[model samples]
Target: MPAPRMSTEQEIEALDEVCQRLAGFEDAISLEWLDGYLTAIVASPRRIERDEWLAKMGQGVFARAYADPADAEQAIKVIDSRFEVLANQLDPELILDDADVLRLAPLMIELSDDDKKQLVADGHIKEDELHLLEQTGEVWAIGFMDATHDFPNDWPDADLETEEGQLFDECMLRVVSLTMEPAELKEVFDELYDGEELTREELIHEALYAAQDMRLYWLDHAPKPPQRRVGELPGRNDPCPCGSGKKFKKCHGAQMQ
Candidate 1:
């Protein structure tokens, strides 16, 4: 028998069904800007454009469609996450409905309601809403995603061979945990070494160095509250790094108090 082929029409139809379900989202994003947003996401192999670039690309009307510039930026984030989930699916037409939603669910880290009270008590972040940091992993970006999906790239595998490589892998996790504003994060990832596989031994060394430097740079610049290996941690907002599928506030973070 001949090998099977992926039907492009089916993929398009599956994405169309998802778009249909986002009626409320389109209303939130304003129907006027929705068409342009969808167009840009489906177009190219380049890194997804940041909001600054998208607004410029969309010209004046996209901003006019929203209440304010910040609202428009958030709408762009919602667009980014949804389309990225669709793009990640190779055979979305065959996907389990619940699995897709779970995969596409807003990258959320729930907060401690009590922590919100304490922050107000201590005069830290003023509002409960401020506790929600808008963070998403852009590992779903078109360039990186395409490169990994079609080619063999060793971009993010933890080496099972050596202990030090394992340590570097852990540090790598911390680097990703650091919160970068969405557009800036996408832009930074797009620039992480030309999106190419580094074959040279020296280049691999440099790649490893980049990972190390990334952790250090963010540690110094975006210092988060130190994480605990044990008891009584305080006032933290990041997702638990333990990979337990629970947000930090609901997981190990909850017990810290």
Candidate 2:
């Protein structure tokens, strides 16, 4: 038999009892299971009525408690802290693609720029694509990509501790300026010289050299151009300085010799 429909207040009180009773277990049953239970508890599914309590309270309450999940770790502590013996759970994978993003608590959320970047990188639903029964987060009844929302004005929204991936403006500008300016300046040098010097290939070689980390590392340590060898020079017929221990005439110096 269908459970008798009660007034909104009665249904909410009944929902609390249901939650408390289920919190009996040391480990959490699936939240979907809870949703299914409460869904069948108060009223018929076909009715237009919504349960004010369960809509706001279900899995969302649990997800929010462990928002930055890395911190509050143990299942025992989580359930014991808030609900006492009512409920305890761990690692709710509420964010679909990037589990780093914590769950969505509300029935709706407007996507932020960070959210869009994460959606694209993680290969979940995109903003332009369609045919959603409703856009949803892994937890709660979140709807994404909306322009305006009807929920609480001050609800906390966002994935805590998701690293800000892109560089700041000043850092980005410096990277572009340092890497590109030398290449551009080479063109100017070529024009001024009437293309007589610094061929395109030569400019590419110079640009690549300038971009090299190894070249930069040695730049300050490079020996100054020598007027002549400061140390002794091997005679043409002497053993090679290259450690082949053969005569200089027979090794690396052989071409000159």
List lDDT for all candidates, in order: 0.39, 0.33
Top model by TM-score, which number?
Answer: 1
Model 2 per-residue lDDT tens digits across residues 1-257:
11212224444344344344444531232332333222222111121122343234333444444345553344323322222111111111212233333121111123566877677678787657533312222111111101003222211232234422111212222212222344564554564335445543344333222212211222233323438656676887898888998988788667775
- For model 2, the superposed segments whose C-alpha errors exceed 4 Å read 1-73, 84-110, 130-257
- Give the Å error, residue 230, model 2: 99
TM-score of each prediction: 0.21, 0.17
Write down the TM-score for model 2: 0.17
- Any idea what lDDT model 2 has? 0.33
lDDT of 1 by residue, 78-183 (tens): 5555455434431222223332121211121234668568877788766755636332222112222233233222234545587645554544433332334545
Q: List the residue pairs that clash in candidate 2.
A: 23-86
